[model samples]
Every structure is written in C-alpha cells, then in structure tokens.
Target: MVSCVALLGGSYDPVHAGHVALAALFADLLQPDQLRIVPAGDPWQKAPLQADAADRVAMLALAFEAARLPIVIDRQEIERHGPSYTIDTLKNVRATLGPGASLVFLMGADQLMQLDSWRDWHALFDYAHLGVAARPGYSLAAASLPPAVAAEITVRQGSLEQLRTTPSGRIYLAETLAVDISATQIRAALRDDDQASLAACSLIPPVVLDYIQQHHLYKN
Candidate 1:
C-alpha cells in the first residue's frame, strides 16, 4: 500500500541548503512512506523565482541523490498558467494520495505568520497535515495571533515518535538546519567572485556547488 506522505513545496529558487535540511529532518521525523518535493513554477505570494523550473528540479534531484529518498517533482502548478496557490497544490496531492493517506503541508514560521493571507487557507487543512518549520531564532507561540491562525493550529510537541500523532502544520520547533543561508547571499557572492563569502555560505549543497562551478550560474 502507498503510505501517507508529507509535501514540501517551494520555489526552490535555487534549492539551497536550508531546503535540503528541512527535507532531511522532516523525512526522519515523519517516517513517511514517501516525501514529495514539489517546486512551484511561479509562486503568487512571492516574486517569480530566479531559477527556471527545469533547473530547480535538476538541482534538487542532484542534492537528494545520495539518499535515494523518493522525491517526486510535482509540477501541477508549473503547468498552470496563473498563480500557484497552496490550496491547489494540496488538492492535487490529496487526490493522488487518496483519503487514507495522511499528507502534511510543510512551511516555515514566516509563512505561518501570514497564513491568514493565503487564498482558501482553511480549505488546505482538509487535504493534508501541516508541518510548520521554525525560522532561525523564531518562537512558535500562538499568542497574539488572529483567531483564525491560532484556533486552527494543531501545535506539535514531544519526541519524534509524537510527531506522527501531532496535528498537521502545527508549530514544529527545529534547530536551524543547514545554517542561516539565503539565495540572495549566494547570488551576491557569485557576482562579486568573493571566495570567502562563497566558502562561508551554508546555501549550496556540495553537488550543487559543483554544478554551479561547471555551469557558471549567475555570471552576469
């Protein structure tokens, strides 16, 4: 039987270390039958990502190749002509997984803070469970939040074992994985030919680093 899975969606704008770290940690905690890495084609909430869909997918595939974990490159939104809503992505995964499969939609703390602003945010809960990752130096307190976000939460706690039973998308506190890295910093370093910044950056997966060197990405 195919198992319930967790869905991690993003632009993967450049598929940085933070993205990979979340994938690794969540895979460990959820122990999903499978973990789908769905990269958005054109995210509506955020600006259009710098990397194209094909490149982003290739980079992610390379980054996760060592583990051989089942990472599906879901392109439902990429195919669509308009904005990519989380609800749409969730709906597609729900259909693929069926009713028995428990799906979790993963997001960072920043996304959760603006959860109320998402289109049909409440409806998304019907499709999958949620895994809200902690941002660097972020606290997951629900106090002072709008009732919609606060009451709807299924806060997570306890050991990895408890994670499976926890409500979806409830705040899941995690140590900063892959360190504090940003796509912008990586791009800047690439532009300036700054070896120190590139070396210090926690953004690139080693394989991705090699790929960047070979392809000379971001050379303007």
Candidate 2:
C-alpha cells in the first residue's frame, strides 16, 4: 500500500472560504495524508499572478486554521524561480514521498478540462493522479478537450475507498461538497457593489475580508 498525498496548489492571493471548503472536502473524500496549499510564484505558462508570493502565502496561513483538516502550506513553488509548473511540483513531491506514494493533484472540473493546455501536461499524468473536483453544473462531457487527452481521462464516483489503493496516474472525480463562489465577483464588489447579490455573498472568510480591508485590495 502507498501513502496518498493530495496536492492543491494555487495563487491564493486572498484565500477565501471556497478554498477552505474545497480543502476540507478533499481531505474528507480522498482522505490523503496531506493537503498542500502551494502558493504559486512566477508561473511560466500563465500571466503573472495577482499578488506577490509572500502576501499569498500569508493569506493562506491565515485562511487555514486548526478547524480545517491538516493542510500544509508548502513553499516549494514559491521558492522556485521561473514557472510553477505542476510537473515540477509533482516531481518534487513524488521524490519526497518516494515510490508507492500516490501523488494526487486536486483541481476543479473547469481546470481539468484545460489540462491539455498546461506545460508538459501529458507528463503530469506520469507523475501524479488527478482529483477532479465536483461542482454544480460542471459537466465532464461538456469539458471540451482534444480527443486524445479526453480518451485518457477516467472519471470516478468520488469514493474514499476507491481512492485508497487505486492505480497511479489515474484521474478521480471527487464528488464532495462544492461551493460555487467566484473571486471575480468578490473583487468587483470592492470596486462596485455586486448587483446580483449582497456583499456577503462572497465565499471568502471574514478574516480574509478583514485583511483585504486592511490592505485595501481591489482598490485603485
């Protein structure tokens, strides 16, 4: 049997409740040994992140508390120069875990569809298995993809045992709790009041909200 590791990396500019909720769900469903909230530094493939690594790392520490599952704020990517490629991160994690350690990278359904666009994406499957997050209105069939990559994906029913001793480098669709909150709306609220919902409609936690207030984020 192999020790399972769940890697959840992102540019947590202002870690919100959505992130917190997802982490908890991932821990509960997959029950991995560690849930890593990797703060992305200079990602090579995408545009520069919104906030600096330090700020994002700080916010992540603040968002995650003892109440949440054991989520480690891994800094490997933050310390690395150049792009924060998933493949690089996976390799580092796999090396640390040694052989038989199942590396599972967690992501939302929307991001899963775009996996083919990532740098050395095909190789990522070689390094780690995938945990496709389940969200409302997120259809696996509708996730537009290249025929070749699409054929390679495997959708699971999101069971804890199913993931316990599964094959390496396979994709698992984790059907756990889903919080449909968008950060764009949160940012827009700072500039102009949200027309669709109230200010508290944001999934961001109060502490993050307070920090953003203190720092005057999203303000010109």
Candidate 2, residues 1-100: lDDT per residue as tens digits? 3488777887775577777777777787777777777878776655566666777777787788654456678899889877788888888887877867
For model 1 the local lDDT of residue 204 reads 82
- Model 1, runs deviating above 4 Å: 144-147, 154-178
The positional error of residue 74 in candidate 1, measured at the CA in angstroms, is 1.1
Model 2: pairs clashing at backbone N, Cα or C within 3 Å: 44-83
Which candidate has the highest TM-score of all?
1
**lDDT value, residue 23 of candidate 2:** 76
Runs in model 2 lying further than 4 Å from the true structure: 44-46, 142-145, 154-162, 193-201
